[model samples]
Target: MSEVIANMSMSLDGFVADTNDGIEQVFGWYGSGDVAVPTAVEWATFRTSEASAGVLRHGLATIGALIGGRRLFDLASGWNGQHPMGVPVFIVTHQEPTDWAHPEAPFTFVTDGIESAVAKAKAAAGDKNVAVASPTVVQQCLDAGLLDAVQVDLVPVLLGQGIPFFGELAKGPVQLDGPTVVEGQGVTHLTYRVRR
Candidate 1:
């Protein structure tokens, strides 16, 4: 059996990505130094905080598979054939992109729905955890009672407007516990258990 965990790094104001502005500000803490066109590996490996790196390492180690949304897939187009997580990723999308269907790519586009995507991800994960990295997918899982835990790396910044992590919770009011707050250098990790 595998647990479904939704994780994200959000601003203090609860914004995930600053819409047209992008997520560079919200996630700036993840990386450091400016380079002339850094590779996807460099983009993924740069770390400003060792604690944040530890958290990410722990997450990647515990999770066997990842589930994301179409927009996220598009944003991470640089991953191409090699993914940073080194695990199969299930992407929820309305339609599969033709150019993205590489045989060597560790990605599966689930056109059916979030549940179907999650089912496949869980199967792939086996006894480990299945991580939902997209906010939309996380909300869908929360609504459908498919999410087991919610983890947010709370960054100390205020994005006036942007994509939010929570939207139209279909399951109504979801009670959270612990929040198991851990203070890092640049971010605070908040882990909450979704009460059924």
Candidate 2:
């Protein structure tokens, strides 16, 4: 069987991106090296230092396919050949893409709805796990009772205001399974095993 999981890094104040959609606030807080992996030993010590492969470690370990919206899909275009999972990714979008570089990644764009996207992602995933990359899409999975777990890396900083991990939810009574904290190179990782 396969499972659907969602993961993202957020700030202590609960914002994913800056108010202007600029992640500079996020990147600035870490200050130095890659946001995914820090090179400084002290920064690593600040983090739990359990994993070293960046988000790829968790994503690849738990999922065979990744699903996200147009924004994230475009953002990942630069890493076409550097995909960590080496699996297919389904993008949920209305506009069709003209360029195709990571053709090997097996991207399927769904315009119908989240259901269609999830169905296609699962099909592509087969027996492996599927990841809902963006918060919006992740919320859809959660609303449909399709998501299995949620993992968030809680970076130590307050964003004042910005795009939150979970924006306006459709409905609530939302519950969370205990969160496990893991210190990374420059950021603290939090993993939650959400439940009903």
Which candidate number would show the highest TM-score if scored against the true structure?
A: 1
Candidate 2 TM-score over all chains jointly: 0.77
The list of candidate 2 runs beyond 4 A from truth reads 24-58, 99-105
Task: State the lDDT of candidate 1 residue by residue for 110-184, as single tens digits.
Answer: 999988998999999989899897778888898889989999989889988998988878768899888887777
Cα deviation at 190, candidate 1, in Å, is 0.5
Clashes of each: 0, 5
Residue-level lDDT of model 2, residues 1-196, one tens digit each, is 8877787777888777887767655544343443343322222321223453455355555577888888776765624634445567778888768787755556677888888888888888888888787778887877887777787767778878788888666767678887776666657667777786
CA lDDT, every model vs. true structure: 0.81, 0.69
Give candidate 1 misplaced runs (Cα > 4 Å): 32-43
- TM-score, per-candidate, Cα-based: 0.90, 0.77
By summed lDDT, the worst window of 10 consecutive residues in model 1 runs over 33-42
Return the lDDT, model 2, position 170. Answer: 71
